[model samples]
Target: MRVLLCTFIQIVMWCGYSIVLFLSHHDHNFYETILMLMFGYFNFLVAQRLNINKSVALNMTISLTLIYVTGKMIIG
Candidate 1:
């Protein structure tokens, strides 16, 4: 289904973002910010397409935080 596909894509994106964030050294750098923003924006689009936009911010934040912590631990 579309939802499943979207969710899978989001997870892949999150992992990719985390990997880049780990490699970037400066987590708060412009590149990382852009990556996060893009992920968030793309996530929002997916939610909007699914008519579930309201929870996008919360979901994105939670996922971002969790992935970030995981990435830190993984690549530390």
Candidate 2:
């Protein structure tokens, strides 16, 4: 249950972050990178508390990277 909730929160947060960045015309500046990293850190905390496997963190990083890269490609 906790794992599911953590996954859901992570997905929602990523989507919200991406939407905000897209709408704001962000240029992937320092602040945007910091915000992204913060979200990753938050996910780490939640996953840790839920006693989830470490691979979840890797998966989150990979997933976010892919989404960000794909969005950049499509937007450009």
Most accurate candidate by lDDT: 2
- As for candidate 2, its clashing pairs are none
lDDT of 2 at 11: 76
Residue ranges of candidate 1 with Cα displaced over 4 Å: 27-34, 46-76
Query: Per-candidate TM vs. native?
Result: 0.51, 0.61
In candidate 2, how many Å is residue 63 off? 3.7
Q: CA lDDT, every prediction? A: 0.68, 0.73
Error of 2 at 61 (Å): 4.7
Instruction: Give the distance in Å from residue 14's predicted Cα in candidate 1 to where it truly belongs.
Output: 0.3
Over 13-69, each residue of candidate 2 has an lDDT whose tens digit, in order, gives 778887877787746588787877887777677677777778876675557656766
In model 2, the worst 10-residue window by lDDT is 57-66
Task: Give the CA lDDT, 0 to 100, for residue 75 in model 1.
Answer: 78
Model 2 root-mean-square deviation: 3.0
What are the C-alpha RMSDs, in order, of all predicted structures? 3.8, 3.0
